[model samples]
Target: MSVPQAKSPPKAFDADSAQRALRLARETLQIEANALIALDQRLADGDHSIVQAVQLLLNCHGRVVVSGIGKSGHIARKIAATLASTGTPALFVHPAEAAHGDLGMITAHDVFIAISNSGEASELMSIGPIIKRMGAKLIAMTGNADSSLGELADVHLNTRVDKEACPLNLAPTASTTAALAMGDALAVAVLDARGFREEDFARSHPGGALGRRLLTHVRDVMRSGADIPAVSADTSLSAALEEITKKGMAMTAIVDVDGRVLGVFTDGDLRRLIEHVQDFTKLSIADVMHANPRTIEPQRLAVDAVAMMEEFRINQLLVADADGILVGALHIHDLTRAKVI
Candidate 1:
């Protein structure tokens, strides 16, 4: 009885397959990590020109205009978004389009952030004279500090990488990643310097999940008036059960004569009551209701409600006002529908 049965045959391992996957993943991650480290090294120790450039953007009453071409253009767009969301006003303007009419997007009070690998992109160079003539500060992000764009800038942010991550060594993989990281560093530095809070960021990202969770309150998603499943405490169990069934909610609130919540009864209660008590019509809902149920304040943020629901592992909650009178009810589904979860 103590003898152990032979272990099942060990799963086969293809060394070639495992090594190929691991090699690719490690190589890619190593390239990106190295590029980021190099970018970090280029940042000045303290309040320097690049730091001052970010400060300038933060202080500008106008917007930050970001421009680049090709892969750098894509990175510039993301950087602009990061800046805008983190409290610095910013928008992306394609270098080519700027030659037509997008240049109007850039005003004298705005700051210009231009990206180029060699610091000699033709499109960026074409708009250079105009940007300078407008008296807008030009902040350059490039690998070549001596190139035309760099020389024309008010501040230079070096995003140089020794080599490209692509096997051909001609693609802009490492350089773009470094540039993006450097851009992020600048935006976040400005954000921290300005003491930008989460609520501020949430305001900028109102359509996103974190924004909804932070800004949406219980009243924004609660079932109100006719939508709420509720009945008076003196109501018979059958009537209360009918209310819950008609509203399609798992539970119904039991209220007193003054419309104040007294208790709650759920599907679980119905099941238990049915098993032990058969006189549903004769029984009063108050006798079997759960008193002092968990509730949330109407003004509480949706994120707080999510936390409470997770902690209690419940799907619904009652919302009360400052006076503890029932205002509304909320279900977990409501949060998901509002994209607040």
Candidate 2:
């Protein structure tokens, strides 16, 4: 055994040192990128292993159990999360933990994925056979196909990298990158084959921004009842201005006796009216209101209202029914408050 001596601390971070750092970073990125390119090329070479793995996942009646050791465990957890969020039922169980009691998480109908760069992680290798005997199909992601884990797998995905990004070539850099890329490829392919939609992904991530955009409806954010600013068609323009100010929506909807939307009066229309007419106090609402205002249905998504507002270049919109009667109102601020903007 040899005791390695520690080196002195780094010098001041000057231009020369910055260049060295940049060069190393660029080389590391290029190496990892090359590894991904090689993985893609290998998959392109008439490899049905990935296809088989995807099929197994698609047909899985239970959750996909992913297990790995060391750095591979991190990648496996990410793969499990991606799969679960994209419509697949999946979870990560540490290989060592599975050897203890987590093995019960695996059922006969589930698909088990074991990731090991060298295909010889003792923990995973020990439990892999047990999971297979339990009737769960096994998929192996490894750099070595001849290793025991690969041999025990129903399908093997080769994640071999020619070399590592680490200058010593002993660190897990390129190998872990390749394994993660392959895992992502599998999850994406399975989700695509399963016809996963954005809304489905949102369902799995309801607290996320996409969930707010997809799951939130116009009715959920729109101002209804006393909150909606409205007036009759025959009302004076001065009175409509009061409704707009009272509602703080900067606009007012004009409906007929049947409560059907006929027009809209906005601050912009008011400004234009003021510029033209000096004393228009007696002006009727119908005379100044813009006819046929853009309207949206309450059942429509709040995101759709955002699109409508952007397209029409307006701030306020009337929520209407199939009969074109006003039900509620929406302002850009409402969407902002709901985090749907």
Candidate 1 per-residue lDDT over residues 152-259, each given as its tens digit: 998988888888878788989999998898888888889998899988988988888778878999999999889889899889888888999998879999887777
- What are the per-residue Cα lDDT tens digits for candidate 2 across 1-341? 99998999978999999999999999999999999999988878887799999999999999999889999999999999989888888999998988899888889999999999999999998898899889999999999999999999999999999999999999999999999889889989998999999989889888999999999999999999999999998898888899999999999999999989999999999888878899877789999888998899999999999999999899999999999999999989999999997
Position 9, candidate 2: lDDT:
94
Candidate of highest lDDT: 2
* lDDT (CA) per prediction: 0.88, 0.93
Clashing pairs in 2: none
What are the C-alpha RMSDs, in order, of all predicted structures? 10.5, 2.3
Best by TM-score: 2
CA shift of 324, model 2, Å: 1.3
Cα RMSD for candidate 1? 10.5
Colliding residue pairs in candidate 1? none
